[model samples]
Target: MDTGTHLVIGLGLAGLAYIDPVVAADPMVSTAVLIGTVAGSQAPDADTLLRLKGNAAYIKNHRGLSHSLPALVLWTALISGILWLVFPALPMWHITMWVFIAVAFHVFTDLFNAYGTQALRPISERWVSWNIIHIFDPVIFSSHVLAIFIWSVHLMRPEILFPILYAFLALYYIWRSWTHYRLESGLRPRDPTYEPGDRYTLIPTVHLHQWQIVKRKQDGSFQLGELRNRKINWIDRVSCAVHPAVEASKAHPNIACFLYFSSYACAELKEHAWGYEVRWADVRYRHRKQYPFVAVLLLDKKLNPIDSYVGWVSDSRLEKKLRMGGA
Candidate 1:
């Protein structure tokens, strides 16, 4: 989830039962306590995508442990242990109890979002990411943004209104997910040639409002289809990887960066005349390194052309250093 989006979620979860005078004064309650505690618990996942120093090992190892129950227990023990040893008089148990809850809540919310989160990692090797919501759904983001503004204005004042409003939003998603399912079920039967070993996908529904359907065909090709209001498959191939190759042929080092985030990346070269432009991202997070992008380009030493790239992140200093050093 985006940081801002997560922040709103974190605050809400932490303060859920602590808003009114009955809960506000308790060390275990209140918006301020909730925000910080939630941030700590949810903050670890951000590093899994190569944040901070941006090392691949950081990217690879971050989610494996941070989202686990053991990690939370250990975190709680350490906090309680330190507080008990240093400030024995403080309400240390409450601190530890709330800390553990905040951590668990963080992992729980991530489990429902699109980015693969390392939930149950040590105990379960499977990664988790809900395709039900877009990484940035306007409805989701706008709701959170609006909540943050309202809450910030009150400055953690004890009020029941925010919680009530948020409760309704939760129900809205339930209904939204229902519509998304209906939209998918209404689509035409998928041609199985692109599926894995003739196996069918649940026909993953992503970007709820956008209503994108990505399913594997019987032929092992991944087809990105749309079903928000209608069914449409614009790109059909073994994978989107080929599009990156086509994109590389017409890309410079800059658009190469663009390819990192383009949803429709393609690569190709011409005999001295070449062209490359993102055909899809005019509406989404353009120039943000991820979203509706089009074909990428690649060129060789003689500016001839070379292989295309796939499955890599752009703008990571650590990746840059590693590649340069490796080269």
Candidate 2:
């Protein structure tokens, strides 16, 4: 989910807190909880500051450590404690409880999207993306916005409204998950060569009808496809064969980090003016105009490394950066 969605969700939770008569009776307690809700909702994303260091650190650690179990507790405590410091006269436990709810909700909702958090870190380093929902769903975000708009006009009581809104959103997730499963089942018969455990990575797009599918086969080949109307349209394919040039390119730091972060990565080795260019990217994000996360390593005619550009580069910027890096 985006930051705006998270912030609105925190506000929704604050509305729910009003259901409790004790919280509703005290304006100071209400202020402390609201403050906690706003800050705690964005605490995990503090890792975005890593962009200052460079894209390498940002891509590698974003949602990895920051969204883990220990980090969740740390964020809740730090944000809640800071609010307690500001309003020492207020009830500390009540502020921490609401703030913890906001922080926990932030981590919980991230699990449903394609770019997931490692919520069970230390227990598992595996990225647990359900791919059930788009990172920014119009339905989810708009519903929250609408509720806030209605509340501002004094149209209804938020305590009664938010629970119903959240309930509808839960049902929406179920409906989307069922649709995703049905569409993916249609792809299996198209390629009967798949064996058990060779499952396709099916991700939902903003458009309800469209889905991105990336499948890896046992024969060292991958297929990228789009699913619409229960039919798949092949977009691209790559072989996982170990070429000498591709093998040597992985020794570079940029290429190594890319492989670690990409869930369904594939590479293309192409001849270039200088020598060779090995391009690597994950098929999950291929729906974008320019692949958001990619690595390009250029090698000389002798197969020795020339230079490389890695991380998020748009179409127009990619060529210029590669040229600059190689020089």
Candidate 3:
């Protein structure tokens, strides 16, 4: 989920904390729980600080260790401990429990989106993306906003209303998951070449019935399409052939980082007067017929990297940069 969604959800969780007798009994404890909940909700993303190092570092580590099992425990303890010192008289266990819930919820919700978290680290480092929801689902976000509004205006009891809202959201997730499963299962029969073990990446859009699907072929190419009304409309094929230039460019840190972060990466090599330019892209996300999340690397005649960039770039800006020799 996006930062704003996470923050609003955090606020909603704080409101939900009113169900606890200890939290409801004392205003001081309530305030502490509020702070702890909000902070814990945003804590795992503390890896955003790695952006100062570079996009490569940030992309590689953003949801890796920070959202792992160990990090969840650390974030809960750290946030609760800091709040404890501030409010030494409050029930420490209640604050700690809510903070832990907030942190765990943040990680859990992240698993449902395309950019998933490495929440199962040590046990497994695989990026567990359920792809059932978009990064910012208006339905989810607006529901929270509406609930917060109602809570602020004292229109309904927090404990009563929030549990109902969450229950609905839970059902919504299950419906989305069923839709995703049906779409994925249907694709195998439609495509003649689809083998049993081949990988398929489905990214959900804000619209309930729309999804972007990527089917990885055995030959390292991707079949991209959009699923509408349970039917797939083929888009384009992105080649991931093992070109020498593409292979050579992988040695660059930017390319390496892009490969690590992208689940469906495809590389294209172009020759220029100065040198070679290799463009690597994640085919999972396509907008307006463009793959915006990419890494571009320029290499001299000897295939030595001259310059490289790893991040999201607009189609126009990317073409302009490539025209200027990856400037």
Candidate 4:
């Protein structure tokens, strides 16, 4: 599931029972639920982080800790406890309990995948990344998107179908996972690379119409080795990002945060609401003396992107000209 799908599904599950009650009851509690809906949203992408650092150790260290039930419970309790300690007059229990319930449900939902979550970790250092649906399943994600769109424009109430649809999705994946496992079991001896270890994510490559397994190698390192896709031999050679084109962008804190917050696939550091700061190469304008282009953006706590058009800045040549004038 994608982050947006996690959000939608989390919201759907949280609101399933309490929607009518919360709406009719105290407005504050309703707002709490809304906040909960917004939180616990990002899809389980602990696996993707492995690719980012080009290793499994980084993901393993951080993934289970933050993504686990224990962490979620402790965090929620601490939040509630602090609230209660600070404002003893308020009913912190309701707030804390609601948040816990919502967030716990969120963590629980991640179990359906081939990479199930590290709900019970330390005792088990395994990282879960389930294979129920592709991490970026357009079909599953679109359902959440369509439902969210309907909610955004219209007063959409929680429907039973959401749960049923979600349940079916989880079950279907469970069955498919078994089938994949059976196929994988039969073929592992033939394919010497198929040593099963923890933190494995089995993803279905859609174009090839076959299942592929990405397992953590015994060296405690994760490898994206090909597995069980020989039936449909078309394999993608495209590897993950080797280098990030953000050296210039990294120099500016504002631009860096904008990159984090705005979720712009690529961020530019050159020009903003205030003025021009950094420069980079891009397709729109390839750093000429005359033409100037810049964009501004903001990112939220959840790293969702928001973009704003800002004033342009001088190109490098013009900047040099300005420096000469000042001198």
TM-scores vs. true structure, each candidate? 0.61, 0.91, 0.95, 0.49
Encode model 3's per-residue lDDT on 187-295: one tens digit a residue: 8777655676667777898888888888887778888988887677888988865667888998899889888877778988888888888899888878888988899
> Which 10 consecutive positions of candidate 1 have the poorest summed lDDT?
276-285
Candidate 1 has an lDDT of 0.49
Clash counts for the predictions, in order: 35, 0, 0, 12
Residue pairs with backbone atoms closer than 3 Å in model 3 (clashes):
none
lDDT, each prediction: 0.49, 0.80, 0.88, 0.47
- Candidate 2 ranges beyond 4 A from true positions: 190-198, 288-290, 301-304, 324-326
What tens-digit string does per-residue lDDT give for candidate 4 at 1-327?
A: 446666776566545434445442665655554554445344234345644552223323434565665777765765556555655554455566666765675566565443346776757755455455454566566666666565556556544445555676677566766766665555545555455553444455432245654444455333343454444222322121222323433434434432322211233343234333333211122123222433333332233333222223554434432322111
lDDT of 2 by residue, 60-152 (tens): 788889899998889988987788789888778877888888988898889988988888997998888888888888898899889888777
Cα shift from native, residue 183, model 3 (Å): 1.9
Q: Which parts of model 1 are misplaced by more than 4 Å?
A: 17-23, 26-32, 46-55, 76-90, 155-159, 188-208, 239-327
lDDT of 1 at 137: 55
Candidate 4 scores a C-alpha RMSD against the true structure in Å of 13.5
Best by TM-score: 3
For candidate 1, write residues 1-327 as lDDT tens digits: 556666666666555545535346665334334644665556556555654543324434555577676776765565456545655554555555665666675666566554456677577756665545655556666776666666668865425645765687789768766765666565545443333343222222334445555554444344454444454554433332334434434344434433333323333233322422222121122224333223223343344333232234343432332222212
Of the two candidates 1 and 2, the one with more favorable lDDT, higher being better, is 2
Candidate scoring better on lDDT of 1 and 4 = 1
